[model samples]
Target: MDNDEPLEPETQDEPETEPAPQNSDETLYCEAEASVAVDKDKAARESSETDLEIEDTEKFFTTGQRELYLEACKLMGVVPVSYFLRNMEESYMNLNHHGLGPNGTKAIAIALVNVSNNDLGLEGARIISEFLQRNISSLWNLQLSGNNFRDESAELLCQALSSNYQIKTLDLSHNQFSDKGGEYVGQMLALNIGLQSLDLSWNHFHVPGAVALCNGLRVNTTLQKLDLSMNGFGNEGATALGEVLRLNNSLVYLDISCNDITNDGVSKISKGLEVNESLKVLKLFLNPMSMDGAVSLILSIKRNPKSKMEEIDISNVLVSEQFLKILDGVCAIHPQLDVMYKSVQGFSAKKALLQWTNPMKLIQGYADQHKITVLDFFKSLNPKGVMTMPVGDFRKAMIQQDKVPVNLHQVRELIRKLDDKTGMVNFSLLKTVKP
Candidate 1:
């Protein structure tokens, strides 16, 4: 009997009935017949379990996640605890999704210490918290994003991380953890020395929460990467993070994009960068920083020319040609730094028509290198202006030179839907000067 494979129902031809003499030998045959009947009944019972059904989820998880799930199932009496995990082991082992409610979570948590791809939404918060509280495993890598497990989940997870010595990464992004929840997470970070990465993006982390997080970072030294993007952390939060950058030596990557951070906040961060040396990558896209803030940041990095900091994202931020020229000269000299100056333009029917047909015209960056009106950056597309610029070529240039991650298939689909007839864009017709 192999444990890995389920027991199959037995199929043996029944023997024909034979007349027996009324003697002592007849008693032994009756006993043997009863035992055979019981064995046949047991096989039928086991075969019924193979009918268990489990649906597959779209998301896929790594091998470790699947192994953890299976270990838990086996501990919880693999046959009795059923939500189709046992039947469809190969197909739906990694996909623990919406169907698993609080009951399902509690059932699995009976044996599970680590879990992922399980969207045990609001209903499963209490169950998940209880599991974390009682969980015995040391190496815990929880990916509970999009669960909507608000304040309680945050506090519970914080408590778990505080005691657990093997916490590697805690990804709570896209949860309803506001600044209040963030405070709990920060408090935990101050104590937990084993945690390496923390992602709190797409939550409701504002100034007060950001302040608490920085307060934690000021003392803690294990965390290396912090993502606070898509939150409501404005200048006040940015200011606190800048202080963290100044004090914390372990942090290397910081993403603060789409947070509504402006000139004041950016300037303060620049001041921190001037004195700091550990940070290598900074993402500041979609912020409303003007030329002064941009210039201040460029000059701040120039002061520490040997700083390990190599990349800065200023895409969609208000930038002047002078700042672009200054940045281009700095990049040319260092050659180690890559200043991403991709300015994303909003959807425009007219602009799309022009950009699809001709080379794009912009104010700075590559265009300033040759002292040309940014159109020279895309000269590779057309040498004689005879070849019309298409979205495919534009995507290539954006990806190759500027390092803009634009998939030509996706970009082409968007452009084709916008202007199906031409299937081209003219970048030279970009509106450079405003009225």
Candidate 2:
């Protein structure tokens, strides 16, 4: 009994002590500390990766070259960008979406490299012009599209280009350069002898500027391809281009689409093609020309058996039976000649009735198709027995498919031809000979 009592007393006296329960806040603090340590390690690794990338980029240029670029930046009072310097050593430099303002642009231009989509304003252009005047041989292709270069900036660039002969391809598209800029470009083109391809598309060049540019092209002996699309070069501008084609022997490919050129402008171009033996490709699409103008173009090709015209793009101009016939004839002679055209002209119909060569044929075709006499159709349109109708009414009637269908331009031409001094179409003229 005594041994059992001693053992029980000893066990009661020595109650085991368990570890204190860990606090919730202490556990959270430990986890946060570990997370912070991991983040610090990751940041160190990222910093090392960035340093390695910089080292790799530095391998692209020699120490001397790097120093030169840095010195240029220092002299120009600009800070050098790491990516720009790295890209400058490559064959093609892509600086798109880089908000390189005027100062940044000047720094890049001093390096004489190709870049795009920079907001290089007038000051930037002036800086580049200074480099261009230096006649740097390293820079061959200059692409300044979508840079917001206005007339003044373009003028500065053109002046610089006048003395430089090393550049071969120059793209000044999608800029705000107007006629003043165009005049400057023309002057530069006249002097520069080494440039081969030029793109001045999507600019604000008008008749005067376009004519001036063409005048320069006429004297230029080196340029091979030119793009003047999406400008305001109207009939007079086309006339000047025609003159360039007539004289210039170097230009092989030309694009003058969407230049507000009409039938008269096309006629002028046709006249130039009659004697031009060097031009191979001509793009005149999106101009408000008709089948008559197309026919004239084909005939011009026919007249000049020596003409080297291989491709003619008039895809915006509609096709007609007479035009196809003439095209077939011309193609028989020039088997290599390619003519690009789209749908036939009409109001939702496949074949158009209106043709500038002969409006009477259109009237006769509709008259025969609807089984009505010309005089009767005119009377239906007039219906007043006054033998005359307003020009607008005649135009509306001519535009209807059930009636004498013609396009708006054809109606205007018809009105001009048939309307007496009273601004009214004489329906009675249907009975007389063709006016």
Candidate 3:
């Protein structure tokens, strides 16, 4: 019974007491102050030389190691739910490893949840779409060419573009999109606000698809460079595109080569150029615009007061001397039209002759004054310097081998003499000589 009364007097000293005259709030304030002081002291001690003597530590994973780690996490069902959520701050740093490295397959799935809400079965597509959407403002040079994307994939891409307002350069070249995909992309362009350059070359956009794009360009004002080359747009497509150019003031460079465009197509484009003052570089090469079309274009250039065209490529067009004369006249007058002519080696020999004929004649006459004949001039013109004469009528002159100019009668006499001697006239030698 006595153990309950004197138990405390026999043992340890009592703890120290504080004066508590403060109100409830003040007491709480004091307790907070005491707690803060204790924490400060503990922090100071923990940061002392003893703790400093311990080595600082960090963890780094190589690309391959990170891939294995993420793969293991995925297989263990720990990545998509917990690992990614816990490492959001490091996600971007890890992206180079996961998105562009071996572990990219696993990291892309987790990253998609943050950017895209699409349930695309492929892991990278949804993730990349989302990343582009989120970083659209910073992705000025986005190159997604040769991605093997389908029409449905283009639809999803258009959906992303409809919401994004900051991508400036988009290279969608070498894709498998047809007119339907082009229509979808055209619709996106009609609504997109920040795109400046679009490369749709090598796509399969026919006249109908071009019409859709024309409709889009009629409204879009931010696009500056558009590459529609290699699309096989014929006269009808050119006409449709010309309609848009008449109204569009933002576009500066237009490439419409290899489109099978004829004079009618060039006419449509000229009509658009009549009003367009912003176009600088126009590529009309590899089209079927004949000499007449080129002459028409030269006339248009002469007439257009707003024609500030800096570069014009009329290569592969059937340009005759008349067309070149017109172009030279325009160049003499304007002096600003920088024309590019890609001469076909053989097909353009006539035009080349017309161009250098006067100079060639002057040089040849100077050489002839030194005893050079027209045959000698032809020999000099040929790469091997071997004179090959004309056939038929010229062959007759060859039979008369004497240097003296022979008349038709003497040519016949020589042919008969050769026939009598050899039983046959040497027509092969006749074939190589000029009249």
Model 2, residue 368: displacement in angstroms? 50
Count clashes in each candidate, considering only residues at least 3 apart in sequence or on different chains.
Answer: 16, 0, 1
Candidate 2: tens digits of C-alpha lDDT, residues 1-435: 121221111001111332233222121111112247766574343323321133567777655345545544544444455556566667675453233445555556646544456666776677667766766345678888878899899889888888888889998899998888888988988999989999999999998889888878889999998999999999999999989989988998899999999999999999999999888889998999988888888899999988877668888777876677777678667654667777665444423433344667777787799888777766776657567886645654565536554544455566666687664788665555473
Model 2: worst 10 consecutive residues (lDDT sum): 6-15
Arrange candidates, best lDDT first.
2, 1, 3
What overall lDDT, based on C-alpha atoms, would model 3 receive against the true structure?
0.56
Better of 1 and 3 by lDDT: 1
Tell me the spans in candidate 1 whose CA falls farther than 4 Å from its real position.
Answer: 1-135, 138-140, 343-435
Candidates 1 and 3 compared by TM-score, better number: 1
Candidate 3 off by > 4 Å? 1-125, 135-137, 344-435
Worst 10 residues of 1 by lDDT: 24-33
Q: Please state the error at residue 214 of candidate 2 in Å.
A: 1.3
Assess every candidate by TM-score: 0.57, 0.61, 0.54
Q: List the residue pairs that clash in candidate 3.
A: 98-104
- Tens digits of per-residue lDDT, candidate 3, 1-435, equal 222232111111212331222221111111112346766574343323221111121133223223433333333222221223334335462221111222323344433322122233333444445545654234455555666665666777777787787778887776667778778888998998889988888778888788777888888889988988888678998998788778888887889888889999998888887777777668888887876676666677677777666557787765554565677677554444555665432455554445433333443456567786644543443344443422222323332234443332233343343342422343334334433
- lDDT head-to-head 2 vs 3, winner: 2
